[model samples]
Target: MSKFWSETVKRCVPYVPGEQLNDANIVKLNTNENPYPPSPKVVEAIKVEAERKLNLYPSPTVDQLRTDIAEYYGLSKDNIFVGNGSDEVLAFSFLAFFEAGKPIRFPAVSYSFYPVYCKLFNISYEEVKLNRDFTLPVEAFFQTDGGVIFPNPNAPTSIYLEIDAIKEIVENNPDQVVIIDEAYIDFASESAVSLINTYNNLLVIQTMSKSRSLAGLRIGFALGNSDLIEGLTRIKDSFNSYTLDRLAIAGAEAAIKDTNYYKSTTREIIHTREWITAEMKKRGFHILPSQANFIFVSHYNKQAEELYAALKDRNVLIRHFNKPGIDNYLRVTIGTNKNMELFLNKLDEILA
Candidate 1:
């Protein structure tokens, strides 16, 4: 470690994202990115904005884009907070709501970024263990000392918690902020955003990367009561007034408006996920019931690391975490139908 590094940098353990390969022939599925391209309207809007003004700085508040997202979710602009990405919004939230000494609670196997944020911000946290079935033990989050956060349709396992259970957690923690990272919510049943109006302490963060096919543009937003939104805004403005660029704002506005296009794409991914699940079961894989666009699975006879290496050798990539309690499982993102067929055919060969 460098002697010049601060205490925060010294203690931080950075999150390792999924492997990103540059090979054109690889069937990439390690990251849960949308398989389809963004809507045509998004591209056109970006092109128009690109030609308008290249020299001037973008809007500091990003007002119009916030309005568009608010309208899409039947909320007012005051209830919205926009950032460069969901990760940034989440970072700002950790700084805004959670305290240094108070311990927060989150699912043990949920998104890896939560712990990273806690460490970076010097916040105390407890990892709430999941049930035997890998489902969230909702009551475990009741009355946290600091606050609570976890993904709905929890990551890596792809097990979704119902909105009723989320409401229970929120109601139980009336004094603490409950942040729901709904990065993959478009592929799931329902959103906790509908309950934001009822619960003043709830904040629901979402991204355009998965459902709207805008990972390249990096647009994410949060929905909550006006007070919570103002808190996030304060944290953001303190750091960077212009968190998003003009192109991103334009593209996101177009993306949120093109609801039908994303809905069709989301349906297609869900269909592919179900088909792949059935195929994997036929090949002796034990899979979880997934509500997200990815599936968590394990083989009856093979080690996860061995399977991961074998697939990588064949120009196919999937995620296999080396952590304890889940070393045998793999998280596979739902690709296109053709891509999935190739993956399944390769798995058949491996199993044989």
Candidate 2:
């Protein structure tokens, strides 16, 4: 502990992201990143941007990229706000909306980062436990609070809450802010972007990290009412005027516009998820119904930690959380068919 550290800094427990190994041959399925390469269009866009604008600072507002995303989502420029990543957008949300006087509520087993954000921003929050089936309990959100934030296809569980359930919560709590982190929405059954027009209190945050295959570029955005967007913009302006550089803005715009490529890649991941889940079930693993590109599975007979370690030793890396209620589960990202085959082969040997 450093003596120069502030009280808040001293108490802070930072978010631990999934492992990124230097070993290229590892069959990485820990982080929920796209297994496919970004669209060729994205590569072209980045090259064009880098060649033309090495000396100039990126557009302070990143207007063109925001407009492209807005048009793609059928929202106006005023309804959208862009940031370095969804984590930054979410941090701004916590600062701009969630407050200490009232308690923000989210699923007990949702994104691990939510609690970290709360601590970072000093936002008082409460954890509402998920039901036995690992689904969000919409009725639990009825209590009074500062705001609410939860992933649609909640992390580590890969369970999704239908848009109707979200609307039910929004319609009931018109006074509080409801931020739905839709980082995994592209792989999910549906999106809540359609509900933004009707509910001013609802803000949907998404990232290019997962389905868009632009995690390295670090671009994310939020869609909401103009006022909510304005609040995020204010927070963003105070922090970093040029959060997105020229290459990132250009690449994200190209990715968003390449609807065909995006859809094709996500569809492939979903298909692989289905096959893997079924196969794992046949091998005695209880796989949760996943709407995201990852599957959360637990075997009745095998230990999750043992499986994770065994896979890692074989140059395959999958994620296992050793926390309460989910200690036995492994969250495995859906990779390409070949990667999945390799993983399954390793599993066969390990289980045998």
Model 1 C-alpha lDDT per residue in residues 1-352, reported as the tens digit of each score:
8999999899999999998889999999899998899999999999999999969999999999999999999999999999998999999999999978899999889899999999999999999998988999888999899989999889989999999999999999999999999999999999999998899999999999999999889998999999999999999989998999999999999999999999999999999999999989988899999999899999999999999999999999999999888899999999999999999988888888
lDDT of each: 0.94, 0.91
Lowest-sum lDDT 10-residue window in model 1:
343-352
lDDT of 2 by residue, 1-352 (tens): 9999998898677999989998889999998889999999999999988889679888888788889999998999999999999988998999999987799899999899998988887889999999999998899997456878899889889999988899998887789999899999999988999999999999999999999988888988999999999999998899988898888888998999999998999999999999998899999999889999899999989999999999999999999887999989999999999999999999999999
Please, what's the RMSD in Å of model 2?
0.8
lDDT of 1 at 152: 88
Could you tell me the TM-score of candidate 1?
0.99
